[model samples]
Target: MQKFFKVYIPIVIALILTGCKEEVKKPADSPIKENEPSSIAVTTASILKEKPKNLAAPEGMVWIPGGELKQGAVPQDKMAMQHEKPAIDVLVDGFFMDITEVTNAQFKKFVAETGYITTAERAIDWEELKKQVPEGTEKPHDSVLQPGALTFKKTKTSVPNLYDFSQWWHWTIGADWRHPNGPDSSIEGKDDYPVVQISFEDALAYCEWAGRRLPTEAEWELAARAGKKGTTFFWGDDISVLQQRANTWEGEFPVTNTKTDGFELRAPVKSYSPNEYGLYDMAGNVWEWTSDWYNNNYYKEVNTTGEVQKNPQGATIPFTPNNPYAKEKVIKGGSFLCSASYCASYRVSARMGSSMDSSLEHTGFRTVATVAMLE
Candidate 1:
């Protein structure tokens, strides 16, 4: 479940070559940990009744009324992972969220206007890369250090196990959001599809340009739950309906994708029905970035009191045993790579940390606007 196989390019490249098998746990594989408060639960059950401002909803965004959210995996979720455990209620003020993951057309516009360059299009910085990896690690060859992003290359046949994800995820040169598959791929006719290969930094830049911001993990969950209660998925608990409801890896992952949803990869936004809040692609399509510093034990801090945390921003600094040096931010939703047999990250409570500078074929993002910002 460690999507950060590309978290630190140099480290991951070395690890993949040696078949590093250390288990990298995510929301789908980890067991719940005992309660240990890192800080006092200061924020408590609070709700914002009136909208922050009465401005009309921004175009292509919807209003998610502030409410009490049972954030994280509910007890009913048999497939829950540790990160989504200790489900805690959180309060978020009313905000406007993009109706879909930011589209290729949208990102293209931003680049054209601002002359913005995505992380994938930038050359690897050895100095920066080394900081995120262990000491004494040798720099990668100059040739392999070119600009690129992680692209999913499906294995022709089944592998021994699903744990080693490096078999399918490869670092491909020139695989930016514009060329999702690599140098050969282009987003030409797919303007409406959710843009992939977007790093956390790229998403933030886009948000600033658009006068919005990435949703907090809490806000993302609140919007994804879409007024639903006790449901494993944003749509509902029924796993059988996922194939029809979302564009997830419908077949054996890393080996075969049956294209059961008419999309072997990403589908255009709004291919499926929207959630109760009129949010599309909230449960799948691609993982969306949230503006929260990820800490594996942060949930315990908020859940200790069993009270709703108001607009809970995450950890002050990113820390996770899996990728200790990698600065990560919480990314929500799942992707087309998600599957029930493998990482069923499409569940509403499912969450994972992505290295801020890492970009992948299966990752993208959406933005949200506070009512105050709208005013």
Candidate 2:
């Protein structure tokens, strides 16, 4: 029988490129004015008129007027992964999404109410893990089975080898969502910061308790695009502008972070200007979990349908060449670790995946409520 094990691994890749360009000047902070003839506003208006009279948006959430979104990267996007190719149009229904990622304070409330224990706080199951490991492989020490989560520590020098992600990621005991760095660290005063070290199971549990659900990959991309279709970043194609618009690595990967955007680690939600759809931290902060099971060729399957996929829920099953036995889920928006010299997954169309049971220092999530839920 196929078995599953929760293994800690840093799945980010550092793509190094040359050619430094001049920094783009920051644009004036003009919020998306109401009554603007934007696609997002128009769709939202229509939905309000047609929705059930009792339909009301949940507090702390904004309506995403979903419409046709050209998902995936364009042919010219060199950084685009194979899975992000052959950009196709997809349609999703309007839904209410949290304006910011679920914050530490928000998650604390859920925990306080439900008395839920996150996966990281629970000990590993060696009996189940043996199924994934090759037969006869030595069992790890009992100490290794202790509760823990993956934590990122910047290296002392520039890492020439990008493939060896273990150079920066360390599995630390007691590093759950409550103690992000380890047992010693606490979220005490960082109530406004986005909660990290959250596994897919933890996020789902929070959603269930809150009467919400995680957004589908399609819905996530649509909201990240924020009515600006085909743009490299939500703000635009000029990567130089990223320093002012999102929280991303501004120096060498895994070694140095200049904190050019006023943050070396996670920033408080809404630290930057909101996207066109009034969504904050959609590009960078922490990689937000989506409800889709990951599959590299899912887009290919959708394209073969020869019609716009309405509310595509992503692949029916997860598949990854890295570890066939490990089930993975889609994660988007990149994080503080993303940089031009390293993991530049902050682009609107970029995607990443992690094991469903794995939790890390840079991963968090938001919740969504659909029209059906409202009714």
Candidate 3:
């Protein structure tokens, strides 16, 4: 979903015109209480469950078997994040995962049943922020400026040079699961498209309603690998001929997309071939959410535990400096944004983070159901 909201010049303009241009500063939000003084004495080794068999997603997902496998980047691959470092041997219990992300039709069912309104669709409580804005500066009646995720373009700039994401992230008022592009855009014709603009809470709500849960970071990575013993991607290690497999950036990212993958926006679930495990679009399409809090030092911390972590979730603290949004959770599997020019995170080992409260067109989730009976 890289700039799907803005890759085309006309769409970008439309976003600005329809979007509110208010700059609401992130307040001193609640701390993620990861550092609870009363820590549980549980260890990863003690909570190990029996491994389950692999199977295909019933209708929405694929099966990921639990077993011992490499859990991080191969040695010499520097692209691995600090949290993805200290590659360790990890084992997982078998689980059923959505073959692809939850589609508009599938998610719509959950929303209809629960009547859940996602965070994206909710209007900002501007009244709460009235005192925060400068006294002299009045908010624009037509401009949008509350906190919201922006769609970025690949400008003629280096990766490190493109830090100013404010250029693309917008604060749309009516953007949500049903209206992905914004208030004006609807899911009427896009039932098969992956649902977007979903927050972590939004995803959790849907999973609960469906009797599923988001996968742990380890489980998500294992499933994305799709039983490719030593391959780099879910299909295979060699991404040299990636165009045939995943729907990633075929040309310049952010600025230009050749649409070699045959899609300028999101493709329908299972649009691509499945892996050995029968999982669809595991590498590209949308960045899937995991049930883990983010921490750059999480890997190092796990290694010292002397056993596997049980249904582990990430710490609530933001490990990066100046990134108040660091407290956000981890997401894996690169979106359509992956490219040699930037964001080469389409690999199975690649990882990224996003704020739990924030939503983006590129961000979505799949369900992981624990195997009821392990063989």
Each model's C-alpha lDDT? 0.78, 0.75, 0.64
Q: Model 1 compared with the native: what TM-score?
A: 0.89
- Candidate 1 local Cα displacement, residue 308, angstroms: 3.1
Measured by lDDT, the strongest candidate is 1
Can you write out model 3's per-residue Cα lDDT over 1-375, one digit (the tens) per residue?
123233233222223322211112222233222212223344335433444335334565555666555666654343444456555556676677777788899998888888898876565555643443334444444345443443433455433433334444554556677767676777898888888878889999998888888988888877777665545577765667677788887775556789988887678887888778777878788888888776667677776875645444555454533343234577888778677655667777777666666677778888888765323
lDDT of 3: 0.64
CA lDDT of 145 in candidate 2?
A: 67
What is the C-alpha local distance difference test score of candidate 1? 0.78
- Per TM-score, the best of the predicted structures is 1
Give one digit per residue, the lDDT tens place, for model 1 in 1-375: 235343346464543222212123334444443322223244433555455554788899988888767778776676777666687766678788999999999999999999999999987788877765567878777877888877788999987777766777787878898999999999999999999999888998999999999999989988888888678898888888887789888777678899988899889999999999899988778888899987777777766766657888977887766555556788888888888767778888887877777778888999998866766
Candidate 1 vs candidate 2, lDDT winner? 1
How does model 2 score by TM-score? 0.86
TM-score of each: 0.89, 0.86, 0.76
Candidate 2 deviant stretches above 4 angstroms = 1-54
Residues forming the 10-long window of minimal summed lDDT in candidate 1: 16-25
